[model samples]
Target: MGVPRAFPHLKMRQRPVNISNFKGSTIALDVMGYVVKGHYRMMKTSGLADDNTLPDSTPGVISSVEDIVRTIVAAGCVVYLVADGKKLPKKAKEHAARAKKRENDLVMAESCFQLGLKKEAKKYLARSTVISPATVDSLKGIAAKFPGKCFYFGALFEADSQLGYLAQNNLCDLVISHDSDMLLFGCPKVLFTMNTKGWGFYYEAVDIPTALGWKKYSYEKFLKMMILAKCDYVKNIAGIGIARAQKIIESSPDLSITSILKTVTTLFPDSGIPDDYATEFDEAYFTYLYSAIVDPMKMESTRISPPPLDLTEEYLSFAGYVHSREQTLDIVLGNIYLDSGRPSRNVTDPSNLDELFPPECFFNSMYEHKKEVLEFDVDGWEGPSPNEDDDEDDERPKKFDCVECDKTFDCLSRLLYQTVTHTNLKAFSCHLCKRTFGYRQTLELHMRIHGGVRKSKCDICGLTFTRQDILTNHMAAHNEARPFQCDQCPKTFKTNSCLHQHKEVHLQVRRYQCENCDLSFKRIRELESHKSTVHYKARPFKCDKCEKDFTRKDYLEQHCLAIHTSERPFVCEICNKTFNDSAGLRKHAAVHSEAKPFRCDICPNMTYKRSDHLTRHMKDTHPAKLEEFMAKKKKAKRPPATSTEEPKKKKPLESTSKANIKIHKLSPQLAKLVGQSMMSQIDIVNKINDIVEEKQLYDPNNHLYAFGDQDLVNVLGVLRFKIANVFNLLNRHLE
Candidate 1:
């Protein structure tokens, strides 16, 4: 399994992407995760075994995968169905432990079901759902439908590693999966939580800086964080979470595995960190970095990336077991059993192969076949033709081989270039940046940035870029394209990346309901505000002039604007009517119009420009139907509410003590001002309030009473005046 809650944690930064956004792109789909998810989804929704038995969700799972693959192919995407082959040797114990737990859970589920604990039984049953290699095999039939468009492959080890390999090597444009670890594996782009509708959350590795709010970050640091928080191959140090791991990595002077581990040991000495933690971390890291993947071009097993020269044979085993070229081809062809190293009996059927995989099926672009159809052996095994010998292919040219890495190149010049990669020699250097390159061509390309040599120019905004790909990306901003539309709202975004963030605001409206009262809130923020205002009776925002306490800053601002200030900033354009807030101005402007846009369903003749006005008419004219209409309206406006009880209140002294503990969190300037004050803390607070009142800072009519300072000069000037007055008052109080 991936790091617990990894997907959800990363999902906050996910961009909402439409399925069609990836049109004409090759996407590697992690078939196993979806297979498991589909099984759970069907079991939960269909309730196929409504009685006291667990449902066989195999059919439902096949249907779900089929729907997903077909939908993706329908969008003009070339789909690669990546299936899990064998578990890594390191994960054997974990797998065994999970298997035992599932067995126990299944027993408990059946017992609970017999006792009529349907809900409890379902929870246990979900945990017991087995997604085996056979479940993955069932999906081959689905892949057969769009044979040319969709191809199937079984990874040597993990499907995620295979997907990541495909993405990193440019075999696929995107990796679509539910696992967040795919990102840690250095997949450039991954689409998570995919639905059949083609909507999903998208992530690109280049956006890590923006996503994590970091000035800069590296893939190495990201992988270390995942390993520290526990991954498939490594155990985690106790008490360390994803957030803590990130902080630990950020605080390190050096983000190297060795330096970060030293820092962890220093920070959490008693956390019982494993002695071989470094080895485990290295294994996990290299496993993600150089995992074995089947090359679509060569049709053979190979590491995702070239392994280090110093890598041990034992460590290399973490990637995957080395398989023969024939075995690798058979695995990709789905002719062998994934769980056991044996030929799949069903795959031997010539009729199934002929029907499912047509002559043009499979990756027709990659392989050059000698025959039109696949040949089967007398022993019920399917593979390449028995007549084809490796010796026949040995006649191909193998000159210009690099001695250092055993890599062959077609030309001597290319071999010379490859040789430079193994050495420190850089004959070519950029004059502007002093950056060295092994080749003259690369140095020339680097000079384009300094010379401002842009060949690609946008027709829309007339912006230029050094590269055509950069210009293509920039064109998206000017294309007036908003492909990502919210399913819950009409709002659209240029990219799917921010769609989920925007939808969160609307999706949770009235979702949190108060158990103690009938009140519900549109967001967690609203519910929190309700709790702080009504339940706890906490007034955080205080009006300095009137010494009145308000639960919200806006409420305090409104109080100051209405009660103390004569300023009416928001004015109706149609009329000369003024209001304190823009909302009031908008409401006032509606009255000036004669148009009645909103029509009452109960009475077609009754129409009003405002929706609320139409609602009011329904209540007044059709009282009986009003409740029904309002009920429907309320349901439409809000999703089902989850009951949340009022949080237990802490004692006043306890709350104050906690507040005092956090006093160090105050700004250094503010803390210094408080420290230098002659008056008591309470008296200083009152004095500051008096100064604010005297300055009329909250008065919107005053020149200094701006909602915000637009520039550094204005901010500094306002702050300087306030500090001077406060200092004078402190000195006077001391005297």
Candidate 2:
């Protein structure tokens, strides 16, 4: 509602002026704004009651208000407390909408409280702030108590408009309010956030032009910019944000609604400017510029009265009558006049009657009594009765008993955890899987997998998810708004979990260790997959046609397309020849480019289309070079060899560096099938080529491998490295 991004740009132009600079000046105070602000500040400092309701008048609120008022008077400024009256007829629609939203928020807050989500409940509760009759009565009581303070309750308009009218008519030199709308209301000067220390921000109307770098800046121009940037009155252009709207406004000399629209459309053609934008803009511009403000001449005259000497008693009496507690009254009075030579009371005594009466005590006594009765006779039925040793309650820790297991614990959290794990207290069960869950939300999430019920759908990609939270996370990918940033690097992520996972890379904490082998992974999921594929030899994904098994689903799909089906999805652009996959097409396209990217470091002239080809060139042409490469590779592969290690513990020469051996012109089918085996692509390729050469899959007459039958193909498809064991296993199967 305030000018969008207005303060960030204007901060450089802001001049720090103290309250002493405004001595002898008259100021119109937005009394309700200060009251609301004070109430929230009090609620924050003083913890909320057990029932989560804010205390009507806290010591903090009274002290803060008194301090502000005292500071203004000491500055020699005549202060008028301006309160909002009835809503304007034109604003009634907005008022009703706001009330409806507040009601919804209150309902959600209550729901969250019932669900034990205290933090979320507090957030919703904060959004439901409203000025009730009690608030008005309290403000009136304050005004009545402090007679010297001039108080004005407007009859037909908001306090902001009335304050602006008074300032414009020279009745007040400055308007003091937290509401930024005071500036838009044509108030000449305004002071904001005045604390007890006589410190606050001073915003002058004359500085607007210089701050915005627009010499011709007027109230009308400012209102138009607010409309374009989106105020309560107008819906902004779909893709036009505050910065873009400012640019549009600054580029045009004439700040008419039509001219602004035309300029925006011309400059940003992709802004998705609506067809009825002009109509909406005109309405918002008119409402802000003309309809919103009250005429200064029509407003009533403002006057300041002298304060009564007996104001302290009036405030003390009012507090006692309203709160019905003498202790609260004492605290309020002490805070109100603490700096005015008045003796203050100690409000921190835990044994005080007011402090002892927690909000939960009023409503939860019956429930507590029932629980106490149940605790006494766990195996038998009993009626509720008062505990005789209630005076000694503070001496011992409260006990919690798990009803299902008949187990008792000193804390409710321990009992609840035990109940979930060791008892049949899980009421929510999945229909399909017959699995029980301790919570209803958990059961609902599990049901999504079996029922295939996905209600939340993304608008852009039409992808659906079982949960709304999941769908919200998915939408972040489309917008590319990574709000969770890494402290170690420039990389940002859409979710906190992603950021947490990325942080482990910097820590290098490989916590998930494989039990069968010494290999470890950073994530538990990766380690589990490794164990299933390598150690357990589980091929869960099966090709439908040939019944060939694969460790991964992607591998099974690739096998079906490359071997079983004649589908060629990727086509070569130069020759128009087609292949089964992109890798095959890339190999074919390399012929058209006439470039050999893979080259041997030892021999500069030796290059090939495939890495395996370059490897064979290095091995066959230079045996000594191959041996040197193998020795270095073997040393790199082995863990740091201990000096005192036994000869038996040392790696056998033949068992090491077998993956380093190379083969030339390997078939595309073998490349993809081996790629899907959950093994390193480079190592697996070399190992497969070794097996093929040992088994004689490659023909002497042709450069390509010739598969004689389906059995031979199947043997190659299921090939994995087991040192010298791989060739013997393939020979036995093929023979």
Which candidate gets the maximum lDDT versus the true structure?
A: 1
TM-score of each candidate? 0.47, 0.41
Q: Per-residue lDDT tens digits of candidate 2, residues 475-577?
A: 8889767889999999999888789988876654455555445555667667756655674444545566885777666777788889988899888887899
lDDT of 1 by residue, 264-287 (tens): 878865455655778888777888
Compared with the true structure, model 2 gives a TM-score of 0.41
What RMSD value applies to candidate 1? 27.8
- What clash count does candidate 1 reach? 5
lDDT of each: 0.66, 0.55
* TM-score result, candidate 1: 0.47
Show where candidate 2 strays beyond 4 Å: 57-63, 88-123, 145-149, 274-276, 292-735
Q: How far is candidate 2 from the true structure (C-alpha RMSD, Å)?
A: 24.9
